[model samples]
Target: MKLLLYPNCSNGGVTAVIRSRANADKENTYLVVFTNDRGGRHSFDDLDNVTVRIVPDFRLGAFLTYLFNEYVFDSINVFSMPKIVEQMVQRDELAVTYEFHSSNMSIVEKEISQLPLDRVASLVVPSQEMKSKLSERLPKRLLPRLQVVPNLVDEFVFNTNGRSDRLSSLEEGLIPLVWIGRLEASKGAHFVPRVLAQLPENYVAIMIVSLESDPTRFDRFLAECDSMGVAHRCHILMDLQQQTVAEFYRSAAARGGWLISTSLMESFGYAVSEAISCGLRVAAFELPVWSRFEEEPKLVQVDAGSVVQMASAVAGKVS
Candidate 1:
């Protein structure tokens, strides 16, 4: 059997899932990916069995090119694309499977509704909450096709074995706090400075590994940290290698601090789980996605706009 995998969003979870499927299956598989917003090609494309087709950002060109490629494949597996569903629904030989990872169920429902339900052989959702939500929205006949495949980081990349010496040098009474993700408004980078301003001096050493796509916005975040006098406590990691990320995890874990996920909206919260997998605890706001994990005791659910509550939550965990 063969599979044509389309991973539209270049988020880490999407890449990890496709890489897992491609590497595990003995059968022939082709990876059809879009140009990464990030400068580099996918790290996992070293697999000899997989062939990749990178499409341009132009929708019309991508649609035509992707439609042309679909003709050669026996089955289509789309991570997210409304047009792909439309194209494949018209084909007889192609079996369709879609993996839904977006936080917006309404958008997914609207897109999936256009495809012929009979052609859709399977539907994969990252979180059980997302699966349940889709089951509720989908027609009764289509509900049986849904499968819950939770999102997971590559365990090796997130391993916690390398920071023994670095962690040993921590100041006598300071906790370590880490926020790892893109430093953008959606990631709650704005709220982080507010939280830091309210915290006590020398209470914790904060490490921020932000892979910001926009330089202007990245500079703004740095400016906020500097103007607030929180720059000393935080280090903004711009070009983070996977190995360095693992070291950050191990260093923070050894120091007994928590990894904070302050994203206003996270479909599955990959960082939260990465921290958990590293044997570190998390203190995230109560997003429905966060509830899917078994760390509610450590969670501090807050209103979407509650900066004070967010600060209080961080302080509660660190102080």
Candidate 2:
């Protein structure tokens, strides 16, 4: 079947989802539509059976309709596009599926109103925790349509290889740490500088500002770092390729660096998982979603909402 995938946002996790599906399902003709704001090296873009288009913002619903009229896909799979999904569901001619990626209550209320849950083939959530949360807000009729399907990471591309021994090459006395995420409140961005302030002087942080992060928020984060007097120790990097991310992870791991996640909520955390897979030890908040990865030995779960605990946990990782 020719399946078309539409995602409302362009973050690393969403891009990874699109690329994974196209690569895994080679027999099907896959068409992917993204807004101009979504940018990533979509590895499947060049595949003969996969057609990818980046249309302008707010034109997505109309663009998908245009593609539908052109008969570009046999069925449609969309992530978190509520109003459009409702419109598509009303159309008896189209086969559709809706994916829920957020656990935010306000967004959940919108889905409860706008998503025609009974009309679609399925309602997909990325994690069981997300499903449990949605189970409360979504209509009982929507329950039967719900399914849990995980996002994928390319094992070969993200694994611990093609990395340098950064341990010996770096300054001998310093311990490095890394943080990767959108500079947003739910990610616990404000807590980062606080955690850095509590850590010892020998420790320094490398902050990787992800795509789609708010520049204003980033400025605030820097100001927080400056106010805490740790701005000089915080290094900011941006727009790195996947290979480079993996390389950073591998090298940081070799140098005894830890991957830190201050996020208060996550549907599924891509950066933390990828860092662990690439051989980095991790110190993250004890989010309920992380129960899925309880067996990972390298992970240290700090008490959520406590900067002192996170700093203490990260410091403990060094020993």
In terms of TM-score, the best-performing candidate is 2
What TM-score would each prediction reach against the true structure? Answer: 0.75, 0.89
Deviating ranges (above 4 Å) for candidate 2? 1-11, 41-49, 58-62, 72-74, 165-170, 212-214, 317-319
Clash pairs, candidate 2, are none
Tens-place lDDT per residue, model 2, 257-293, is: 8898988888878788889889898888888889978
Best by lDDT: 2
User: Candidate 1 lDDT, tens digit per residue, 1-319?
Assistant: 3445443434344555665556665477665565444432454546677766566546634564556565466556777665656665665556678777666556687767766666788988887778778888788888889998776576656666655444556677666777776665677776676667777765454545444556888788778888888877765555454445567777777766767777877667877877776777676666777766653454456667676776677667432
TM value for model 1: 0.75
Error of 2 at 148 (Å): 0.4
Per-candidate Cα RMSD to the true structure, in Å, reads 4.3, 2.7
Worst 10 residues of 1 by lDDT: 1-10
